[model samples]
Target chain A: MTVPAAAAAGYSLLVLAAVVAPAVVLESAGDRGGVRGAVGADLIGVSAAVGVPAAVLAWRGVRRTTRAGRSRTDVWIAASCGLVTVAVAASALPTVVLHATTGLPVLDADAGWPVPALWAVCLGAAVVAGEASRRGVLRWLAG
Target chain B: MPALNRRQFLAASLGAVGSVAAGTGLGSQLWPLMGREDLVPGRTPELVLPAGAWSPAADRLTFAAVGDTGSGGRQAMAVADRMARGYQDSPYGLVTHLGDLCYYGSVEDRFDDVFTRPMRPLIDAGVAFELAIGNHDGALHHSDASLAEIDAELRLLGTPARHYTTSHGPVDFFYLDSSTPGLFGDDASVQLEWLDDALASSTNQWKVVCMHHPVYSSGAHGSTPGADELLEPLLADRRVDLVLSGHDHHYERTHPVDGVTYVVSGGGCKTTPVRPGRFTAAASSTLQYLHVDVVGDRLTGRSVRADGRVVDRFELRAREGR
Candidate 1:
């Protein structure tokens, strides 16, 4: 119960961070140009669209795991949710950092590749971390 | 392996055909959406300038100018329609874009929707467009990627350099990339030096400068202090006749600041409310475009709205010996 509640809260916080923080940073940077407004709205929309369902499914999986014990399917579902949340967070980090540092609202020309690569790495990491926790490997390793 | 049964073989073949058909249908629909050319019609009304407005002199040159029109929405289409109509009547060979070619992203990503489709009528009619990098168009204040993408897209649109000079019959137009660093600082010295050279070498009767930032504007963005500091001295010293810009989403023409008429023809697609400042001779928040006719020493300018209403008009006569 505690694990599920904590995970859900953390996931929600991650989504909020990714969607809301960038807009604040950008507004503080300078004028709210049309592009920044559109991009900010888009980030919020995409986060809500992808985050809500992922969080719900992840919460359900965590609850089932708590009652029925760890299962491969349940772990995978939770891992997928984490992957999505992390990927979105990672992708937005560059834009936010750039705006904060230079008051620029755009990513670098080579920025497109880093986002997809981050997503892939996040997906892999989520899967590995989920499997390790389910197997108690993370607990043993931590010890 | 055993030979496939007749039933299984038929089902597999049908599945393959069905999959291919579905993929084809989806691709066809997605392609046009991505290109944003789906909404643009094949033909639109040709734009016509008013009677006797077209300059008959061989030395005279005509062009259309607008900015902040990257929306590719209804208002943008309406303005583009009017521009096409004006082109039909006067046959202007060039169009000047004052930046913000595409809102919310690099022009490379939205060029099809924001530029190609909306301006199709004019493009097909053989009109060439010159671009200035605006803040929304990925200027110096935007990310490096945005700047790179915009530069690449500009090249694709036939602008070889971000800042360069081009000439018409009697006008030497200096296109400055004001989005670069030193816009108000020492870095502007490079552009200032180039501008000084360009003005000095030009043998044309009329000298004009175009950039994305406004040096004298009363619109929402008001005047860019840096641009005023860096460019005004050069403009006044060289006796430049006209300074064209767009950033504030409105139209404004200033009383000559040191003999240079500052015009903000930014009402290309979107409209933002504006109040007249001390230097403003005329100002409006209508979606509009500008048609300028350079005949002899006089430059006649008309601001035409999306619905074809001429909202503002003014003239600038070159000073003696300019």
Candidate 2:
């Protein structure tokens, strides 16, 4: 499940924000629980949709590409995949666990399975983009 | 009836055959390399540096800068702790880690014991544990999330000021971040611009540029020609004083080029062999760090070991009042 670059970047940013947001809230909130919780929940939702797929795609992509062979392209792809994987995992983790422990459905109908849908779209886009970028780079080099 | 039955059976059979072929193809491709790729573990958080802190006075400052020290577990911790104990002053300013704080650029619970827990004292102090991200620090493959998270964590830890200059006294320190793997594009232009600004802005008697990779080295990583070509001339133009780095895990000092000294105090984690390069003034493969002291215009710098013995010392005249 390779993730597209734009989506991956978005996920990376969101994950970092989620982790840092807590600290920021702690710094500024002065003990506002409701607001912090709302922000935290939103961050979790974003992570679930973008972050999980990005990570899954990256890990699988790296594993598949590396095992396939050791071309420079493969290595680069593998790395890209791995990076997305880490980002996805880091961002989605806290909320996923929290939801599960609280007996809340991991996939709620209100969210309309957005994470799964985004996974499909981003993964498709990533494959197309990766190939296109690779070819473009090669073509430019040849010229 | 007979024609319709034949068409339906044929179409269903074709679909089943295609599905089987696809499943088999996927299995054949994915099954073989599972052990090698899946089982090979990422970096485990081992003690790279021991737990302790140190402080240098208003007249003299003591600190350690190290890079590529994310591995070696207990051995790394032992060396770091020994160094920490060596500078067991009442208040230690902090450790300036060049980068590669966590191996594979991801967080691990195991690393807390090895990396974070021990350095709590330093965090407690006003000591600035400055860090710059490394090529490996951003992510294992291409993930920037880990990098962002690390940056976020560091910021929360009160080290948010990336690529800023500070002065203990007469020593003006310029901290810069080199390019990471997928992001920042490996161009030194932005860092160089900041560096140029930092140097031009500073009237501080001594200027020190500290980064992760060595612009000059004879170690395993070798010399970064791009850095030398791009950065050296700028430093020369600015009449900068000292350049410090820690990419290769060894200690090295270069002859003053363009009136600037280059020191590689990389012996923070692992040990690599030292071969003399064109600019090397003193080179050591042993674990060591630099202790810099400033008194008025006379700036004194020393490279000390884990055992607390001075390896190299030099003096540079203050830039202006001299």
Candidate 3:
């Protein structure tokens, strides 16, 4: 409901993603077992790398909005964004599991996760940056 | 407190929708498992050309073998055109794309006009193509998908004789898919059996194997540890005459290993620095293709650069069993 609360949740989700996603991929890699799996796990790790930064931004944005009495709208936006971050990280869980458990590349078995991860990162960055910039500008203009 | 202002409510609603949309649709798509078609055009995966039928030369067959030329933009195009003109001057049998069909292995999005249109001459001239998958053909900053894409393309290429033995004249050719899981375990077991049977029973004079990953490489990607451990012994044991690969993005020919000549001609799309005078008898980093001349019992192979110069040459002596 509040900006701070939403921001905290976003960051928490980010940390969770960074820690858990790679573990799953590595485990998956071990099970499948090979260079292919290693590459697959690596993809999970890459997603985490991107996801962590996104989570941090979402949190900071929410915090700033709530503090500025923009919580009526910014809080909800931040919450929704936070959920998106978690979902993106979660969707990669199977791949992380595959690479972490098996030692095979996740994409080897007829499916892959890299394309979706790429698209997500681009869209996430755009949204976060757009909101953050817009809010900052509005605040400045008001002053 | 005063009731919420309409403008504030409107702005907030817009931000919420924007954030959610950004987070869901775009972020979901970024999942890494997304297909080739999902990638934005001209980003990572590039769209090359649509599929078409091609015919090989009846005699004096020639084709371009290129690798690592996927990213040079203008330079790559120039090289491709030169090869195309060469194809025109003396019609090439086919264009054997070594690998890294696109840089960073981004698939559909990575293709550009330079790659698609510049090689038009070759495509239009009816030069059949054999493309292998490269490391860069996979993922970026993440797991590589290029190998999978290569496999998909291979199947898509409609070469129904998946991993078959064929002849162009005096030369016998064997095309293989040597990617990870396939090259190892059960798949390897089956293919190896097929290879041994084919090599033992074939009537052709010269035998050669083609694949995407290399059993020996000295380029940026270097040798695949898995390949050496699993596949090299097969080559040596079979006394296979020649092995051609593409992942390294350079051209190299080696002294016969167990009576087999290992050639790395990965310069199809881009060029990277290569380790010199190591295992190779001859090597180059230029955009080049291999032209094999099969005349009766003697098969001569030349590495021709994009500029139309024959850069390297070797001969495969015919064996008696066939």
Instruction: Name the candidate, 2 or 3, with the larger TM-score value.
Output: 2
Candidate 1: tens digits of C-alpha lDDT, residues A55-87? 454455455655566533334333433434343
In candidate 3, stretches whose alpha carbon ends up further than 4 angstroms from where it belongs are A1-143, B1-60, B104-116, B136-148, B185-187
Candidate closer to the true structure by DockQ (higher is better), 1 or 3 = 3
Best DockQ among the predictions, by candidate number: 3
Q: After superposition, how far is residue B308 of candidate 1 from its true place, in Å?
A: 0.8
Residue B34 shift from truth in candidate 2, angstroms: 25
Error of 2 at B147 (Å): 3.5
Native-vs-model 3 lDDT? 0.55
- Top TM-score model: 1
Question: lDDT ranking from best to worst?
Answer: 1, 3, 2
DockQ per candidate, 2 decimals: 0.02, 0.02, 0.06
**Per-residue lDDT of candidate 2, residues B137-226 (tens digit):** 555333557657556545644555557777765567777766443213454467677788878888766777777777788887877657
For candidate 2, what is the DockQ-based docking class?
A: incorrect
lDDT of 3 by residue, B7-38 (tens): 55565565567556745653455332321111
The per-model lDDT (C-alpha) reads 0.63, 0.52, 0.55
What would the TM-scores of all predictions be? 0.59, 0.53, 0.52
